[model samples]
Target: MSGRSVKKGKRPQNSGNVLAVETKTTTTAQNNVKFCLNHMQSGFSVEDLSKEARAEFAMALFKRRGMTWTEIQQAPKHGLGSEKMPASSIRAAIPRVFGDVENFLVLRYSGLLPMAGVRVGDVYHIVWLEPQFGDLYDHG
Candidate 1:
């Protein structure tokens, strides 16, 4: 049996100088930009990138860690300047699981190298790391 004594729907009272901690829910925190690589395509893996390219990729992520998705999409040259890539514009076939994703966001990680991902909530799930421009899709 549990030793704690607390009434139903009632929080236990703090006896001494301890303060109760509550979690704050904020929209800004919820909308902050985050990146994930779980969905990255096999051939476009980061492991294949050259040493210089890899360093640039890490630096890019570090530079934008504090920005929100909106800020990343809105700023001028420094921003991600993401473009929409519809399925029709994509050269490679996406897995059936992501069939309903409709479109993907393509951004440059280094010079014109396209990094494609899907946004779910605040997380941008990386799907591809196209090292060469126009290799994955038409940029025209």
Candidate 2:
């Protein structure tokens, strides 16, 4: 029902125009569902990422969900970083399961370091992403 509403069996045959019109699958075009759940509240904009970083953000989220912290940290590409968000609203936003909101885990991919947030249980609440740097310090 996306483009040119047609009957179930009325899809056009193998044609470039048909495929382009019917099977478009770019991230933004197809699914608006975000990979990072609630990390937007961590103080940043999604527009900050380059296109490559945007792609990697999805990749990091997919991988982080499955891998243990031990498994994820073993990769040379991954590093640990934190930001100081001492605000009460920030702590109140996350579920009580996230133990402490002092710091968060970083998943580095494609020169982008995305926050994996202070996850105590499973399911990470990803926040902002920073491009590669020697270290991350919150400017405030």
What TM-score does each of the candidates earn? 0.74, 0.45
Which one is best on lDDT?
Answer: 1
Prediction RMSDs, each to the true structure? 7.5, 11.9
Find the 10 residues in a row with the least total lDDT in model 2. 26-35
What lDDT, from 0 to 1, does candidate 2 have? 0.47
Per-residue lDDT tens digits for candidate 1, residues 29-123, read 33667789887777776886788888888877787788877787786542466777887777776866677888988767887787887888677
Q: What is candidate 2's lDDT per residue for 85-127, written digit by digit as tens?
A: 4434332244455545665654555554544454443334555
lDDT of 1: 0.75
Off by over 4 Å in 1: 1-25, 28-30, 77-79
Task: Give the residue spans of candidate 2 off by over 4 A.
Answer: 1-36, 77-100, 131-140
TM-score between candidate 2 and the true structure: 0.45
